[model samples]
Target: MNHISLYAQSLVYIVAGLNHFLNPRTYLAIMPPYIPAHQFMVTISGIAEIILGIGLLFRATQSVSAWGLIFLLIAIFPANVYMATSAKFIKFPAWLRWLRLPLQAVLIWWAYRYT
Candidate 1:
């Protein structure tokens, strides 16, 4: 289960990394309005994600990847909070809607443990 989770998480991050290229405008749109130099931010984030995904591919780098992911998640959290508050961007089932924020914490913990 530990390996399974790590692999799954790694795959998700890889896909998300690719997303920066596949949908560059959408990725940029997510940046908070106060942010400047949106293009640079998106490109840097994409590169980081891809690098982190590759790092997670090896056991020797797994712990470092885990810590990197934890910080990555923390860094993007304000976007999650923004999305949660802006119903225009998020629509969760009644049961799951309330769980999103808390689940981010759980996911961070889970990655920390299994990574």
Candidate 2:
């Protein structure tokens, strides 16, 4: 059961990382204007996700990978805030947008579980 959960977590990050490259505009759209180099940041995050996800596959690296994800999630939280608060993102339902804020906490906790 532990292994299954670990693998599932890994899959989630791997796919999410891939999505950054495959659909960068989605991430870019939500980025706060205050953040510089949207494209570079997205690419770096994607690569980090891929590397950390792979790291979780090994016992020696699982804890470290989990810590990295926790930090990554925290680092990108401003984008989530931007999506929720910016008038430009009004197309999304307000409730759903607001909900993403708490979802970040869930994701942080999820990563912490592996630590």
Candidate 3:
């Protein structure tokens, strides 16, 4: 079960990272107004996700990779807040938007398990 979950989480991060490059507009849209260089941030985040996800597969790097993921999730948290609160994202249901905030915590907890 541990191995299964580790692989699953790694895959999730890898695909999500890829999605940043494949659908950059979506990521850009949710970036907080205070953040600078939306495109660059998206690109860097994608690269980090890909690297960390791959690192999780190696026994030597698994714990460090999990720590990286925790920080990454924390770093992007403002975007989740922006999505929930901004009028620009009003098309999404209010409940769903708000749900993203707590979901980040869940993601952080999941990453911690690997650490």
Candidate 4:
């Protein structure tokens, strides 16, 4: 169970990191309207995610990486809330609509356990 959970967390971040490079424009599209220098901010976020994802792979860095991700998730949570509220623009299924909010909390909890 521990391995599965850690692997899942690692996979999520790794995929997110890849998406940062592959579909960077899509990531940029999700930035909140209130943020300035949107493209630059998106790019910076991508870099951070990628670095954290890589760091998570090492046993030595596992705890710190998990903690880092928790903070990162918290920092970007507003975007998730914004997307959830703007369903017209987002258009997710009802089940998945509010799912991420709680999922973030769970992920944070699980990540913290590594430390």
- Compared with the true structure, what per-residue lDDT tens digits does model 1 show for residues 1-115? 7678777888878898899999998767567777678798888888778888777878899889878878887877765665566565555564454566787798688668746
For model 4, the superposed segments whose C-alpha errors exceed 4 Å read: 87-90
CA shift of 22, model 4, Å: 1.1
The lDDT of model 3 is 0.95
Error of 2 at 5 (Å): 1.7
Best by lDDT: 3
| Whole-structure CA lDDT of model 4 | 0.76
Against the unseen true structure, what C-alpha lDDT does each candidate score? 0.76, 0.93, 0.95, 0.76
What is candidate 2's lDDT per residue for 5-82, written digit by digit as tens?
889889999999999999999999988999999999999999999999998999899999999999999999999999
Q: Residues 1-115, candidate 3: write the lDDT tens digits.
A: 9999999999999999999999999999998989999999999999999999999999999999999999999999999998999999888999999999999999999999989
Q: Estimate each model's TM-score.
A: 0.79, 0.96, 0.98, 0.83
lDDT, residue 33, model 2 = 92
Models sorted by lDDT, best on top = 3, 2, 1, 4
Query: Model 1: number of clashes?
Result: 0
CA lDDT of 115 in candidate 1?
A: 62
Give the clash count for each candidate: 0, 0, 0, 0
